[model samples]
Target: MRQPSSSAPPPAESLDAVQAALGAEHAAIWVYGLVSAFLPEQFEAPVGEGTTAHRARRDTTERLLADAGQTPRPPEPAYVAPQPVTDQASALAVLVVAESDTAVAWRAVLERTDDKALRTSALEALTGAAVRATRWRRAAGETPAARAFPGQPA
Candidate 1:
């Protein structure tokens, strides 16, 4: 990634971390779309909300990368789900996995950056994903829906 023209450009490692977060955002958006068909009409609102949230985050991440003089990585044509989403339960499970992945990526960005603004952004992203993951887990009837230490490796 090219350094920003500003005198206080973010470190390359931080930029790379942000890029990874951006990629996670892309995957989350894709997963949201993919799960729509498998979900019931009762899930329509939540699915739309999830798609909107991920799209907004993706746009913000792309802008951040552009401002840092890095070309944002494009999303893959498709993403493989953790398991077959043949029903609502499996679909919710995949959503939980997507949000967990997003949280992990944002946490990596937080660890790699000393930039206060970036840290704040990353923290918000991580928290949002963690909450979403919890919601999905609950919807899937998983016990202990809330993660005690979100973004930490199990």
Candidate 2:
């Protein structure tokens, strides 16, 4: 059986963590696309915002994967969503959870990396996911989803 990773300082200059972050970026792009379809036609503003965010993430991660000499894995045909999203309320819920998951994966890169630039990139990714999560939560009349991140709250 595989052992779990610890908080020990990561191996030097390995791009593995960054590669894993790219995979997460891929999944998030897929999720955002799926959720966008659930927005009402009158909510063009939110739909546009969501589409832009996902596209930027997908494009940037694809470039990072290429520049790092890694091939980004394509997302699977279907993913097991955390829950069913049959309406606006449920769709916002999915968006919130999916963004949180994306943040968690990007945070892993920050934990597992030594490259300064990669760490900064991971931080940016985390911030963006968090912001999107907050926006969706507000749209759904839910509390801000931000919480103690990278570690449990004290």
The top-ranked prediction according to lDDT is 1
Query: Which 10-residue window in model 2 sums to the lowest lDDT?
Result: 1-10
- List RMSD in Å for every model shown: 2.2, 7.1
Kindly list the per-residue Cα lDDT of model 2 for residues 1-154, writing each as its tens digit.
Answer: 3333533333534456655666666667677677767878766686677667766876777776655555766767778778887888888888777777778778877777776776887788788787878778788887645565632112
lDDT of 1 by residue, 21-112 (tens): 89999999999988999998988998898899899989999998888778999998877887988988889989999999999999999999
Model 1 alpha-carbon drift over 4 Å, by segment:
1-7
Worst 10 residues of 1 by lDDT: 1-10
Model 1 lDDT, residue 110, Cα: 93
Which residue ranges in model 2 land beyond 4 Å of their true spot?
A: 1-14, 150-154
Clashing pairs in 2: none
What overall lDDT goes with each candidate model? Answer: 0.90, 0.70
Q: What is the lDDT of residue 30 in candidate 2?
A: 71
lDDT value, residue 29 of candidate 2: 68
